[model samples]
Target: MNAEFVAVFVGSSIRFAAPLMLASTGELISERAGVLNMSVEGMMLSGAFLGAAGAWATGNAALGLAIGMLVVLPIALLQAFLSVTLRANQIVTGIGINILALGATTLAYRELFGERSSAVIPGLARWSPPGLGAIPVIGEPVFHQVWLVYLGLAILLATSLVMRRTALGVALHAVGAAPRSVDQSGLSVTRLRYGAVLFSGVMSGAAGCFISIGDIHTFTEGMTGGAGYLAIAAIIFGNWKIGRTVGACLLFGAASALQFQLPLIGVHVPTALLVMLPYLLALIAVAGLIGRQTAPLALTQPFRR
Candidate 1:
């Protein structure tokens, strides 16, 4: 492909990956802290619905984003309560929550915007670094993006630092590996795990908002689709490491972008196949095709103390 085509492809990849990057960052931390956090998909869907609804209602995308993130706290708390406090089956609880969120969002969308389905929702503005947007052929297409893309990168950097270079990071890692030891060290395993899951929820909320108010500027029932699951797949593909996880997200994003790009290039690959590429890679990762996975010792185990 030509330079401009390549630049557009690169830009589309980043845009598609932005939400995955946001959600996976939090999911990585949550998984590291030993909570399976299956409800990420549900949390994302809820956020997307709430964010879009709020933006449409108030004509303010920022407030909508805030509402989306804030609203997910309770859902995250519910996930934490079930997985941590009540020690419920993490996978089942997460799947159930996902189903519930799907139904609830679909119904709510119908009730709130049934008559005005075409109403334009305010979307977040695109931005580029001071000089990045001024470059020649690759400038705008490659650099201009929703502000959330930059924010997600910042959060990813901060999370990596916190995960690698701080006492809290050590505690989080320790809690997942050996909760008994964490408790012995006078730390509350329950508290750490809960906090991690809550953080994951907030990130998922932002990710959902990115889809509804940042990129699409609109919402539809179940708009999150399977992005949350894709985020989890990204974590597995990256072997639970932050840097590798980002790479995985970008890879999946490129696969998504190809669904549009290939058609333009007169490569009429099945759209379904392009859409399935990420999940297919996810399955390969889970099947141990890429490499051996080293998960946290107590990833889904409940802590009692």
Candidate 2:
């Protein structure tokens, strides 16, 4: 590949992978807590729309992020309640949440911004750090990302540290793998699950915000498309680990970047085929699900008292 192509590829991967890393990592946390969230797609789209709209209205990226987080937090809380406290069917409730968020956001958008032939939405500005761009090869595209891209790397590292080496990590693990045993030990399983769900929501909101502020900078119908679903898939592929999830994100990123550049690469592939790579890979990966890995013992089971 040409030097410029490599730079663009890496840059696009970083941009595409950043959101996946963030969202997938969030899903990892929730799944580790034994609560599967089906609403990530809806949450992402809603967050993106709200974040973009907020930025447009106030012209402040930070405020838009706050709004996006706020939009998804409640949904996370509900998941915690239904799955952790109420002991509802995790899969069904999760899917329900996705539907609710999708409908709610779409309707809200229509009410707030009347439907027209085309809608104009402004998003956050990109920031390329100085000096870093001067590095050979990977500097330009990699370093010239938004502030959130940098923050995402930090968050991923910190999360890994917490999961790998920390007291809270152990407690969270206990709550997921064996809520009854944890409860007998005098810990509140519901509370821990609630915290995990909320944190996941916050991170997902951040992911959605990145899509609005980083890539499109404008809200469209189904702005997040299927990113939330992809996040869930990434978590499954990563087997609930922060580091592995990063790999999954990168894989999907490459697929996504390829879809957009197949023509430039002098290929005459079918458009539909190119667009399906990421999802197809996800199907293959998930289908190859190997030996039974241990999930949170209390997974999808509500904890009472």
Candidate 3:
């Protein structure tokens, strides 16, 4: 391929991966804290709908993004209440929430934009680092991106540091591995788990917004598709490590970009197959094809103090 094509491909990969990166970052933290937050799909869909609607109403993408994140708090709280407080089955609750979010968002979209479905929504502005954007041929195409991509990268770095080098990180790890010990040490397991879930919700909100506003600059019913589940799959594929998970997300992003890229080079591959690539990798990862996985001991187990 030409240099320009390669540059565009790389940029597209990063753009597509941004949402996965954001969602997986939070989901990793939540899983590490022993909550298998399955409601991520629902949260993302809700955020996509809300962000689109808000931007349409207020004519401000940033404000819409804020509204989306803020609105998901109640949903996250409900997930925490059900899984952490009521000790409901995590998988079941997550699936139910996904179904509910899908229906609710679809209904809301139809009711709110039935006639104006084709209206243009404001999108987040593109940005690049001061030095990077000034580089040679490969600069603009590869570096210029929605601001959320940079924000996601920053959050990933901060999260990695916090997970590896602090008291709170230790406590979070311990809570997932040995909640009883965390309880014995006078830490509040419930609080940590709740916070983790809430963080996941907010990140999922950003991820959904990345799709609807950051990339497409429009909203479509169920536009998120299965990106949320793919984030979970990325976690599993990475063996629950932060860096590996990010790499998995990028790999998936490249696979997604290939759906469009290959066709341009006269390499006609099926779009459906490219879309399924990430999930296929996820299944392989789950089936222990890559290596043995070491999950937190108390993952998905209700902490009974």
Candidate 4:
């Protein structure tokens, strides 16, 4: 409504979008490498749990963040091994991993926290770019974000450059679209897919850590709450491109912010609709923009050689 409100809204939108942006970047790469990693949700959950636990135990959010990212590698490896080596059904494997992560995280939380659920954990520090923080009304409110947000943006830019302008990027793209050709060319499709899945796991872990530590400064059972799926939907909505996918994440974040803003502005919108808006838009975008087209030619297909 007002300038101040608008700034807050915009800032909140960015915060909400950061995780999806991070996860989507990783997913894009994994999919580009011909591995349809379905377990991003589970990976994110594991990261959140591990990151939070590490932070609480060490009293250092940075250490927690590192631990979270490190711990998710095994899960990612499992996904890659199943989808890449065994040629398991990607969707089933991903869903199964998600279920397992949810149960495990819940049980672990109960066991670790016990009655100390209300205790506080150290959160990531917040910082704003020097010049950007100086603006009058909109600057601080919008730019003073957790440092991880900045880190994520940097990673996004680096990913964009790598995806658009690098030999390895070409290899990744080739692996997804023409794995047989890649294999024939002496590249190991298996290795490429494994690397991509591992990268996705690391990014998912970072994203999850952002939620549990950077944003909430705490952990709760099932904290990811479908955000992982949202990231996948974001990839579909973005048509697998980095720039468009980032935009899609921001759009979803704005939709999420509206749930709170609408009430404040005296706009009588249904809560359910506001919450469902992002998913609905993603579905529509996918349907309208992706009809009849297909993903990478070799996506989910294991290399025979």
The TM-score values for the models, in the order shown, are: 0.98, 0.93, 0.98, 0.97
Candidate 2's C-alpha runs over 4 A off are 117-120, 289-294
| Model 3 stretches astray by more than 4 angstroms | none
For model 2, how does the per-residue alpha-carbon lDDT over 1-305 read when each residue is reduced to its tens digit?
68877788878877888888888877788888778877777778778877877887888878988898887888888877888777888889888887887787778777777664245555555666778878887787767887788888888889889987998888888777887888898877777788988888888888998997667776666777788888888876776667777888888898888877667878778888867888887776677564344555666666666
Local distance difference test values of all predictions, in order: 0.93, 0.79, 0.91, 0.90
lDDT leader: 1
Candidate 4's residue-wise lDDT over 33-151, tens digit each? 98878899999999998999999999999999999999999999999999998989998999999999999998999899983596678999999999998899999889999999999
Cα RMSD for candidate 1?
Answer: 0.9
lDDT, candidate 2, residue 179? 76
Better of 1 and 4 by TM-score: 1
How do the candidates rank by TM-score, highest first? 1, 3, 4, 2
- Candidate 1 C-alpha lDDT tens digits along 101-141: 99999899889989359667999999999999999988999
Query: Mind sharing the TM-score for model 4?
Result: 0.97
Residue pairs in steric clash, candidate 1? none
Q: What digit string (tens of lDDT, one per residue) describes model 3 on residues 1-305? A: 89989998999999888999999999999999999999999999999889988998999999999988889889899999999999999999999999999999989988998835876899999999999997887789899999989989999999999999999999889999999999999889999999999999999999998898888888888889899999998998898999999998999899889888899889988788988887787778778888888888899999997
Minimum summed lDDT over a 10-residue window in model 1 is located at 111-120
Please state every model's RMSD to the true fold in angstroms. 0.9, 1.9, 1.1, 1.4
